[model samples]
Target: MSRGKTASALDLPRPDTLDAGKQQGAYEALRGAILNRQLPAGSRLPSTRSLAERWLVSRGTLEAAFDRLHSEGYVQRVAGSGTRVCAVIPEQFIAAPLAREIPRRPVAPDQPDAGVQSHVPFVARRPDASLFDLKTWARCISRGLLTVGPGVLEAAHPAGLPELRAQIADYLRSYRGMQCEADEVIVTTGIRHALDLIARSVLKPGDTACVEDPGYLPARRLFALAGAHIHAIPVTADGLDTAQLPEAARLAYVTPAHQAPLGMTLSVSRRLALLDWAARADAWVVEDDYDSEYNYNTAPLAALKSLDSGDRVIYCGSFNKNLFPGLRVGFMVVPNVLRRSMLRTLQLTGHSVGASDQLGLVEFLRSGAFVRHLRASRQAYQARRDALLECLGGHCTVSGQQAGLHFVLWLPPGVEEGDFCSRAAAVGLTLQPLGKFCHALALPPAVIIGYTALTLAQIRFHGRALAQLL
Candidate 1:
């Protein structure tokens, strides 16, 4: 019998079985393994030496098989990292996999209680509402009530409560290095509302708007709602790639302080180039200055709005990051030239925020309580982040350590991101996949590990669990 026929007896495909050649037979077997998810996304293959031995084939045959898979986009050969299965499997192969469903990992009895609606597993961007100072918050509400007058109760400027605006302006100046005055500040429910206002004021139907590729999804969805053409630009190690920005976009939205998911601060050089692009193109830049206050490593870079020379930047910030999201309060600082028109748009739409909530936040800002809360929260989150890093050592690579509530954890080759997350969720720990954040780009398989809301004990426990799963 031929040597190839001898290999066939071992369940390896014989070289003579197909018209394409020996390489084709090997490819089919490997492809079947991939399609069956026996080798899941981000999983590394055995070395050619090992695979050749297992299949009773030569090393050259295995190499040829790998080359074909790489060419077809079923796998990737990252520099320094070995070959890994693509997170987005090729469409043709995907149909076969859909024939069978991936079974859900059964939840164990010892699992922690996932909220009725929320399956968050120590997720990112979530602040701990339990830590809130109830006494101080109540006192602020009482102060607003006692001091409430007819003027405050009746129709007032759509720009927001004058006191709250002034407080925000002062806070921005001291903390973010933005040199705006009270007239520049406009109160909104949160960043989404702020972006909606910007879209209404600046963007028109068919106007192009640029956003980061693997970015905040809600922002991208908001741009789509405004009838604008959305462009997904790639985010680099530093931050958003300003060079990839279209020269004719009407507006661009970015998170510079702590980039949305990647967490890298926009470099000074990129910031300059972005502002230059905005100025020369006559475009508006929305600086979503979210979560800059919780930086743990270096003092944060000065905000992007601080570098704007042409008054082209619209600065948006929120108390939600430092406090809680349910507060539904945020503020935007528009350029003086655009402030009047933006306010008019807001007024016409009747987007006036609640008077009591504004007054309560105003008190929170004035009484030094906000800064105190920030200081304490920063320390607590830092501890959680440190605990995660400690447990994560040697298991996977973690990035975006400088700021924000969460960081990206890139699993090593041979580990499957989806499978890892499923096992985690089965144990009552819900982890978010990084692929969900991408629009027009494919990122290395990863998960965003948020540490802000989790305590050290929780971090250590979950982190250990995650490490074991890896």
Candidate 2:
């Protein structure tokens, strides 16, 4: 470890006094100081020339140490000047948010967005206003117009593009092992639309639907918006806890392929129980097989619909995760008995996603590009997940990595996930608090780290910074 590079010792911690093992120690210590705001954001660091002289270490050693710090996000480079502490370290990362998690009033669903309740403006989400596959899609769209009748473009089927429906069926049979036909597939904008359709199609405004308590927020919101009373069922390490499901609900929305936030696959036992309960209760099961594309474990699990001999499950799939988020095409395989009602619901809701995009996507699927792209993306996302695990392993206990685009980390009890994330962001890291996914008042503090959108190097870099914030 004796000065691996030509760089000299870093400034602060007086490098000359430290032994080989201690360089790492000094590097970490300084990183903490910057995040803790002791060094103060934007403050210039002593030059390598100055640090070498002060610490009595060779220039090579000091430079290497600074590179480590820079990668970890504590240090930054300026064009004209030398290295500086990153400007605008979030006040809450090291410092606590002034507000408490619990308020005197009950947190209502209709309450204004939480951002409005805080001193800080809402932290904008990562820009996904546009997705990456638009160019390939545009060509397909043009080709679709050439192939289909003018009448296909004239009126919208709330059920979505028919050609897309047919293609979705073919793709599912080839890929996911679902025995569905075109008529069974109800195409919608994406996962959210799938949720809205099921919620609206099945239950009355006041009827209850069992949902994972610590679950996808959009599912809870969509059901609530549709006037269904949401029953928050607990989700365990093996997916949603079917035993915890109450007797009242007539519908249940699930991510059986891989549970969100917790990355657990529904065990064979739980899947059976879930299906049986739905059948016995005469209830609807909306299966959101959202991220089966990026499975890092064994092969992807079959959708609940695939196992539904009783025909209780309505399974949904989409290209959002396989391609990009805004592809705006997803299909559902509802029970044949409910087809008319589901289609009627789709029509009433105006969930038409235009036929052109669907046809282009169908063509993309038929060409075998969709499968090939998934194979490539699977490797890419798995590598990113590995980087996230490796970089953050020494800092936090990581969880939920078997499948899907993101994973969850349980912050220590006294720690505040949101507060740490804000601080980390000031230094250019974007980690969402785990608690952000929770719907309950007494939710545990955690953060959901999404790795699909970033490169492995980026994951290592930003994840290291986020680890420091933790």
* lDDT, residue 413, model 2: 66
For the record, the alpha-carbon RMSD of candidate 1 to the native fold, in angstroms, is 25.9
Instruction: Write one digit per residue (lDDT tens) for candidate 2, span 1-470.
Output: 22322232333656333566556645755667687666787777776666666666676766777888887677786555677887765444677666757657876777655421111111222112233456666777777778886977786666767677888888788777788888888887887888887777787889898888678888888888878888888787788889978777888988887787677888889999998888788888888888877778788876777788998888887776667655677778888898899888887767777677777887787766677777777787788678768877765776777787777777876878768777876987555665666665356777766767675556677767766766
The candidate maximizing lDDT is: 1
Record all residue pairs in model 1 with backbone atoms less than 3 Å apart, i.e. clashing: none
Clashes of 2: 14
Q: Which stretches of candidate 1 lie over 4 Å from their true place?
A: 1-119
Q: For model 1, what is the C-alpha lDDT against the true structure?
A: 0.82
Q: For residues 1-470, what per-residue lDDT tens digits would candidate 1 score against the true structure?
A: 32122221223333343345667878887787788787788877666665677767788987898899999998887654657789988976555546667899998788754421221555645787767898899999779867876578785868889999999999989998988899889999888889888888888889999999799988888888889999999998888999998898998899998888888889999999999999889998999988899888688888899999899899999887779867888999888888878888898888778888888988999998999999988888888788888997865788887788889888777667788788888887777788888998988888877777776777788888888777
